[model samples]
Target: PYPQHHQQRQEIFFGNGLTANYQARLRYMIARYAHYDHILAWEVFNEIDLTQAADEQLVSWTEAALDFLAEHDPYQRLRTVSWLRERWPEMLALPNLTLLQVHRYIPHLEHVGPSDSDVIAAMLSDVIHLRHAQRPFIFMEVGHHGHDDSDVPGNHLDRSGVALLQKSWAGFLLGGAGTGMSWWWDSWLEDNDLWRLYAPMQRAFSLIQWDDPGLRPMPVDLGSDMRILGWQSSRQALIWPHSRWSSWHNQLLQPGNNPHLGKRFAVTLQSMSPGRRYSQLAIHMRSGAVVAAHTLHADGHGRLQLKLPPYDGSIVLIITPQP
Candidate 1:
């Protein structure tokens, strides 16, 4: 009754009975489907570590699969595979497997709620712990369980789509290759009409020089229980001040606590050049519109305080050199 049974995995990857047939099938599928522009990448396998195959066979198969893709996939969509977060360090060395991915879930091995800290920390730790990959990393699959497909059966309680957005923002801001890839698109996402949520990420990212090599995570003090995270280059910074004040319990669960909604925030940005004039632009994430524009010069310790506009969910602050 199990979907991805251990014997089936072994057969698919190495048991030799179906290995050649599987490769031929993959080639046929690629030739027919690889030309679609929307198809991002070919994932070699999903959570292959969960299979019964030995480590050596998994690595060998990954290498061979990647080679197979390179030979056949002329369109050359990117390549990735998922592990259950650091289960196979050996797989990271496959140079042709250009992306690293982890499937993160709450209560996997720890007791945690779906609080801001819980969801954010779960993915954030992936970015931090998988730092050695030296390749683009992403949370390839995330939800409340080992399997998140709603078509089957079970309760994955993100009724309001708050967790999805939070994880997306957190994944991107924390140096991931893309937003946290949630697993419930057919159910929660389409059901709630939450496709509009992408506007925030798209607009904010449009204004950021995110590819700059000099960008590194910077410390910030927002003077409250805010999730203050920023990455800075010598001349600019992108800061996200996320409120843990009322989002999870209120917006996601109860859906009535709006007191912390639309509250303005004051922030102290650290790790800047002292006395340098900078122009600040605030991205009101709801509308993806720029608000709270101002200019400020950093103090002696390379800190600058700026009052960001009132926003219910969160706001993005971009600091750049004054012209």
Candidate 2:
């Protein structure tokens, strides 16, 4: 219990007895559940930016709250918080708070909303660009547009669940800690039994060496109706190409609206060791099958050109330096 929840929680942040009660509850929760190993970091708040508490007050309260957690908890687990606006640098810059979280749901087009990958990329880019210190960012809450009261379907209302799946993949593939914990898990995904949609991420995520700190997001120049987004370290590179023509809007609302995209695509993978040979495997995202595998040697300019086999939804490409 921190001073960073909705407007109603503001009273607990200020009220004398209320604040003590909140602390007691927090301590009780820790004493009871901290023994478990599976629990992730202690999230200080869901979306503090939505709260009525002032930033200065929230910052002071958060520091004390974090100290309290460290003092009481025997495990001394990781601590973090979430923000919709990313406005509190003082809170984010706290060294003890190692993880930065944001809940993203921005819209695009008239009523089509932003594409799935676009949302992740935008949130990630915001966290990367806004933070005072380098910290791991996670999309703690994400969905098309928060499943609001609008009678009209906002951006991603696809029955196929592809929209949310794309966002999840982009979060991991674009260098996040894991897939975005989409907001509509029970109502949208679970209600429709969309758990199987994430099957492709397991194998594709395994291909990444996440411990490598040098892995950076690399730009992909594509000559097709797709955009390749991923990262590359010295030893390996992983990227996903999602068709620009087939997006949340068209695929969900207007399926097959775009003209037939070519089965083959051409692209140059940049920022690898020049004149080096690498093993490249193009895996189908939906089925997690290796559709194409080849030995690709980069030119002296550090560019490896390749052709992607025909795919419907999306594809994950894995490239590793050959010995």
Candidate 3:
């Protein structure tokens, strides 16, 4: 409901007796702003399913709008629209939509759980689903609910900030085009002083050369409960692991009783060059610090198994081969 000057409060939805006017407004927006080089993408609408329209109508409306944007936008910025989890299949089918976008929250609407493991497991499942998208995928909204939840204790900061941070890193390493974008940016993040969490993520991602064409998703086997996600090029690999049981909210809510912290485990790397000895294997904290390094050898079948150090939460493993 932005552009309050012209937008009717109740007319945001498509097929709401104002389709013509909405189309005209969209035309005006493209003509006005499509020339801006910094504009990343054009989102047709946010959470269109919330309109409660029939699925057929929504899909038709989405296709038409996507067609208009595709034909008119001079720069052809990435086209995307957000959808509830149930409507994801329809959204993915839109021919002109260049980027896949999904909206998810902790204690999901259908499957609610405040448990740290439950939340991570759910989020990871969603990420796995998005892997089928031909184009890049992104989690458009991720965070704890802005409203008070009777199931969890403490304010949003104590309850959701750490979970937000954890999910962001998880989404990024799990092949998301970008980290999960937190909703309620002003009130939930900045006001609560949780904005500082982005610093470490920024540093960690900066080490990656995203433009390298060889970088592609790679398989990682950390066994059950523990998950490993990674991408590899011929020269290097980036691996990230997460424990299903650890969460910041749990740590804060119960200081002495945190069972998920400080655990050691072996992670196996697959699809490596068989019988090749990698020059360096470095483990990095999410804050972008190198905690450990090793020279490792892959087995005959192109797998390498390494025992990781004991630590709370998640860590990134970077493997590099001699040139």
Global Cα RMSD, each model:
4.5, 4.2, 4.5
Instruction: Provide the clash count, candidate 2.
Output: 0
Off by over 4 Å in 2: 1-12, 15-18, 106-121, 130-132, 146-156, 219-226, 257-260, 311-313
Off by over 4 Å in 3: 1-13, 16-18, 108-117, 148-160, 211-214, 218-223, 252-260, 275-286
Locate the minimum summed-lDDT window of 10 residues in model 3: 148-157
Could you give candidate 3's per-residue lDDT for residues 1-323 as a string of tens digits? Answer: 44463224433555453377778988999989989988778888888777676777678788888888899887889998887754467768889999887666765333434643355556666766667777898877877653544333333435337766766776677688888887767666666677777876776666666777888875434355676666777556777666645654455544555554677778777777788777543544435577777888888988877657785665677776644
TM-score of 3: 0.81
Error of 1 at 65 (Å): 1.1
**TM-scores, one per candidate:** 0.79, 0.82, 0.81
Please provide, for model 1 over 126-236, each residue's C-alpha lDDT reduced to its tens digit, 9 standing for 90 to 100.
667566567777777765453445332212455556666776777777777787787767776787676787887887776767777778765433345777766778678
RMSD of 3: 4.5
Better of 1 and 2 by lDDT: 1
lDDT per residue as tens, model 2, 187-292: 6676667777678778877877778777877653344566777888766788877666666656665767766365666777766788999898888776788988
Best by lDDT: 1
Identify the candidate with maximal TM-score. Answer: 2
**What is candidate 1's CA lDDT for residue 84?**
68
Residue 72, candidate 1: alpha-carbon lDDT: 85
